[model samples]
Target: MPYQKLTAKELLALGNAAPEVNDSSWCVTWDPSEEGSAAERLVLDTLPPVLDFHTSGSTGPSRCWRRTRETAWLEAGMLAEFVGAGTPHAPGAVVAFAPPLHVYGALATFLVPARLGVPVWYRKEYVGALPETGQRRALVVATPWIFSLLLRHLDWVRSFEHLTVLYSSAMLPSDAGTLLEQAGPGRVTLVELLGSTETGGIAVRRWEGGESPVWTLFPDVTRVDGDAPGDEGAVPLVIRSPRLGHRPGEPQPAEWHTGDLVEPLDDRTFRLVGRIGRLVKVNGRRVNLDETEHRLRARLHCADLALVPVSDPMIGEHVDFYVVPALDTRADELDLSPVLALLGARPRRVHVVPAISRSALGKLRPQQTP
Candidate 1:
């Protein structure tokens, strides 16, 4: 069967007009709280009850999951309310650069408007000059990479007037956040949503002027017990949320242990510290880069170092240890022969650099081989 794409205006029209009686492979059962939209009512009356979404696989292998229409409706409603849609202060329309196939884009472009009656627009991909819409405000759904590119190309001050950006998939670089704030001041705001395909939106954080880094849990999501200390003072967090999706016939687990390590800031907020597991599988052997880095630092008595894992087709993931020698010690005087022999061919590459760029929060920025 051919794919049927629905636009925001057309979806609204479907809600207002008579829906076709023909049965679809898909069906919808809208949430009870979703109101004021003819299309939303039509979804409750007619549509597929379930849909399958594929994970982006940024952290690991991608998997397919099924979600009920009600879950989608509820999540969309929550997100719309969070972004202040449907009110006088709401954005003129939603503009998503991500493809709707991904969960993040689906929620931003499809589900959110389905609940709040917001008009929507889309881009083919995260590239090219953004078309100027005369609207005073726009809700932009994008990722960190796109933001970086936008910062390079666009006129920051004039372009971002009254714009709200939802950034996810990866952490936003601190410099980009700072530049955005400087460019637009109060007119532009960046919201970082911590979520995944399996769990939906769990928490959100924003860049405040000189505030500490922390993420606030969504009202429905709660932290579970059994969090234990992992390597390097990293404490893993478990979560229980209604938005969590489960496979068919599998009993819902008490909680999902998200591999993320976080430090509690208060009853409701937390700062992400690191990951519980940094072990990468390489050629039937496990390589713990964190441990290796620790050992290297202990032996070398140097603190300015980072071990970045880059994916390889043959080895799964290999380490690239970046070192910044002490001011007195020349890079030529440094020796890693012992470290290499201990690892037994774990790292595929190593480099000595003058300095390493880090985010404002003191986290290493993502690096690519130069």
Candidate 2:
């Protein structure tokens, strides 16, 4: 049946959904959400109700994400309230620059719009002008990178009755948010999200004249100083959210040690500091690149291996491991299950090269800031 023929409740009733649905055979491509999209197709599958998704594995390997239908409704409602579209009867629309393939994109755009029973746009339509929302506000779902490109065209800012751009991935330069909110004072609302595929929607901050340093967390999410030995002011973020997403081999309602360190102001809010130690936050989990490299070195018996954290617009940071094997591993039938497990620590991409060749003077060519 076409997704438009089904209701939200009926769709969720379809249990055991697939992990990822990218087949063009599905319906709804860049069409309005009220008309439904491929999301409906995924639910129609006769599989057991296992809702699975994945992070955009741009830098590293993509990780499997497990979510439930109940959590989907909960998060969509949370996001709708965040952007001032709480009332399902209210007039509002969602415009998405990102696709449902990632967690952030799916929740903010697909699920939220479906919950609101509102018209929506996604995929290719993002390149076009804002949807005509009439008296209703339009919520835009995008990333830090897409914001830069969209800013180049402010022709549509004042076009909507009201516009709210929901951003995730990473915080941008403060001036970026300022520029957006200032486009139309109360007429425009810019909300930046501090969450991941693992933690779902943990916190949100609305940018006014400039982006604020503090973030307001969701009701179910709690932030605390990490228990690990660390400074009082700077420590890993100990997050306990009921709606937290699946982690391999971990149960729900468990505390997630967000690799991020933050100075606590209260239980629901905090000032975000950077990641802890050599660990960089990727999809809400901290990956210890240094330690991962050490393990690879020990197991592979190769001295020319290093892991570098690469920044991504979608998944924050991913690790790319550069390895100079004594012999080509692929050709030698090397068992790489151990490294595969280590790569699971974060999103990863593996590079097996001939050598870690350095300049004649031992000068590094270019280093990426983690």
Candidate 3:
């Protein structure tokens, strides 16, 4: 059956029932009302033993990628091995609260359980509720936004004593991790994933307990550059893995240049700095937006901050800092003196917005350069 032919309720049902289906069963869900006839025909005509997912356009335009059954199985096996090795725990039932469209959420929450033959339950709505009894060794996969929502509803979050793993991804702010660890009593293993749609899911890290951010690359993936690619201080990450899927007009490179900057700690571990495009030249000096934003965030009491570029006559572009201040805080009252002092340069402008606009997955919305 074509995916476009199904309704939203049907799609949700399919996802909910996917965990119960046997390995031989190929399950898929689509909203026919929104997709129209072409999408329906494609789903009906294609017998995809593999699963394909649309990338979250968190940073830029979204793209679709396919995950073959074999590759998916491999990914599951690798994750199980890694998780078990790092934290002595056996595989168990998984509860996914994130949308299936996101690769990290889908793979970690849904496909992993399916490949492992573990019973899984999915909640399409982010109500911050935990599953009741009868679900054993449950792994909860969600984003920081959902986590924050759950925190607000403490009664719902406290229901899960069986939670062995708490996996968060997309946009996991440092403070959020700290709060979740405190709330969970540090019993639940909090894992943050790092990877994209093109590379599938690559690595996982423990974001709480003051643990250093180190990502263990998937067994199938290998770092192409001796270190990662970028400036001497920073390295650009390149991936050579079988899990990556090809788009229609994508160049067949031996490895995919991720265009993400990183700091390589060792052969197996690295810390992601930011995207290469986030680097901007200011006064003939290169400034990494990620670093500047980090500094600004650390100094200022703001919910979120972004350093974007604005057109300049003398310089090609000048940096403008946008911030979403904490509740009851005014932009005028903000003591940006420390931030400006640290940067050694003032922003062309600082705009205080109501909320930091983000995509569905909570990633910063992509901005177009004027």
TM-score of every prediction relative to native: 0.66, 0.61, 0.72
Tell me the alpha-carbon RMSD of every candidate. 10.5, 12.9, 8.1
User: Judged by TM-score, which candidate is best?
Assistant: 3
Off by over 4 Å in 1: 1-6, 9-37, 45-47, 86-89, 156-160, 231-234, 278-318, 321-370
Return the candidate ranking by lDDT, descending: 1, 3, 2
lDDT of 3 by residue, 1-370 (tens): 1112233334334542253321111223322232334433333334245566666676678876666645655665566554442343543556565565566655665445544444455555554345542533456666655556555655544555534444544445554554566556644556666777777766677644565567777767788673534665887888888888666455434677777777877778887776777776677767777667656665788777777766788767677777788877877887788657755678888777877666656666667222
**How many clashes in candidate 2?**
10
What clash pairs does model 2 have? 15-48, 15-49, 16-48, 16-49, 16-50, 17-50, 60-347, 60-348, 60-349, 61-348
Considering every candidate listed, which one attains the maximal lDDT?
1
Model 2 Cα lDDT, one tens digit per residue, 1-370? 1123234443334321322221111222223443233444433332234457665443235577677766776787778777775443243666666555567766765577765566555433324444444545677777544555556656666565667777876435333654566566666667778877777888888865553658778888877656774444566787888777785565664778876767777777777765454566666655655456545655774436566667777666777666665653552565556666877653466666666533211111234222
How high is the CA lDDT of each candidate model? 0.62, 0.59, 0.59
Model 3: lDDT of residue 179? 54
Worst 10 residues of 3 by lDDT: 21-30
Alpha carbon lDDT of residue 279, candidate 3? 75
Candidate 3 wrongly placed segments (more than 4 Å) = 1-47, 83-88, 133-136, 153-171, 184-186, 226-229, 249-253, 280-288, 291-304, 309-313, 316-318, 325-342, 368-370
